[model samples]
Target: MDPIQRITTPTLDVLDALLTVDGPAWGLLVIKATGRQAGTVYPILERLERQGWITSSWDDETDRPGPRRRLYEFTPDGVDAARDLVAARPSAATPAPSAATPARPARSARPVTS
Candidate 1:
């Protein structure tokens, strides 16, 4: 895909989520991975497809009972581009600490009064 003009945090999140998967990923899987809403994830996926960064196809399996899911995967060039882009952004590589992780206390510049 031509270099993404608007690379927002949400877009990075989606790319990161896709990269984590070994194979093609579905819309709901992306949403859950990125913790983003359908409104956010679907548009990004569409944009990526339009840009030629990714391609999508409907799941062909008929044995399962649910609706056919659309699976998305990066094109060969897209994977290279995405990895370079994501690596350049250090913030995206480092995940935010969760509630279970202890927060570091801020060090005071001035001494505390007894």
Candidate 2:
């Protein structure tokens, strides 16, 4: 399946949140940003990691499986991709349709002539 097609709005939201956060975040923050369940968010995170879009490592300083966190952060490619995503964001601030680029005249709308 197409990767973009598989990416839901939540997936994009989660990705954006990760980029926004300077440090690694726990699963909870991801769930909050995407408004998705832990189950759903984790899988997407794993997929992104496996795809080399992001990387994750357990905090050495944190107590593993205790209060420790499994933090994640974007790779260089991920940053580039995020920038691309941001640029692609549609903005309402954009001016209305310009008359310069008029809609194409429909073939069916051609006038009947003798």
Candidate 3:
């Protein structure tokens, strides 16, 4: 697989989401896991597939009563690459700030008239 040219945060998030799953992940699952919209997730998936980082196939289960979902999983080499990439980003491992942690107040745009 060619090296990913630009590893954006959304891409990292998608990779991280994929890592958490045991088997091939569908697009919506990745979307929900990353809390990213379809617009952002689908393109990343397509790019990853094009770069050979991942492979996709249409779900063939006949019993399922819905549209065939495209399943995506990393190639043997892709998994290692993805893990290394995700691990290198410190922010990826950082947990979301909890409610107990006070949020920083947003600065007002208007200048103070004092």
Candidate 4:
């Protein structure tokens, strides 16, 4: 397994989302993308930053109050990492065919003794 490909579950999801978009995404966008709350999304984004898979900066243009919204973007490795993760997503489970459909082989008849 590639070392970077082993990124934690939440981090992988965040990176994949960032990779899909044309530019960086703010926290709310990430939240919407992953259906994850800020509590979960922020921590994962921090981890991705630490891993060097993604980078973030404050968005001064956003109208949000308090601090500028932190926007995230994927590094080259982040894109590669996302690709690996996507390739690794477990295939959807498929039900096995019914056993009843297979026919049993017929037994050969034995010759009768004289």
Best by lDDT: 3
Predictions in order: lDDT: 0.93, 0.73, 0.95, 0.74
TM-score of 2: 0.65
Q: For model 3, give the 10-residue run with minimal summed lDDT.
A: 87-96
Give residue 41's lDDT in candidate 1 (0 to 100). Answer: 99
> Which pairs, if any, clash in model 2?
none
Question: On residues 1-114, what C-alpha lDDT tens digit does candidate 3 reach at each position?
Answer: 999998999999999999999999999999999999999999999999999999999999999998999999999999999999999899655678999989999987997797
Tens digits of lDDT, candidate 2, 4-111: 435566667778788778778777788887689888889888887877777888778844456767788888887687666655555522557888898877776678
- Whole-model alpha-carbon lDDT for candidate 2: 0.73
Pick by TM-score: which candidate is best?
3
Off by over 4 Å in 3: 91-114
For model 2, the superposed segments whose C-alpha errors exceed 4 Å read 1-5, 63-65, 91-114
List per-candidate RMSD values in Å. 8.0, 9.9, 7.1, 12.4
At residue 111, give the lDDT of candidate 2: 82
Q: Residue 73 of model 2: what lDDT?
A: 84
Q: Give the per-residue lDDT of model 1 (tens digit) for 7-89.
A: 88899999999999999999999999999999999999999999999999999999988999999999999998888888877
Candidate 1 ranges beyond 4 A from true positions: 91-114
Instruction: Please tell me which model should have the higher TM-score, number 3 or number 4.
Output: 3
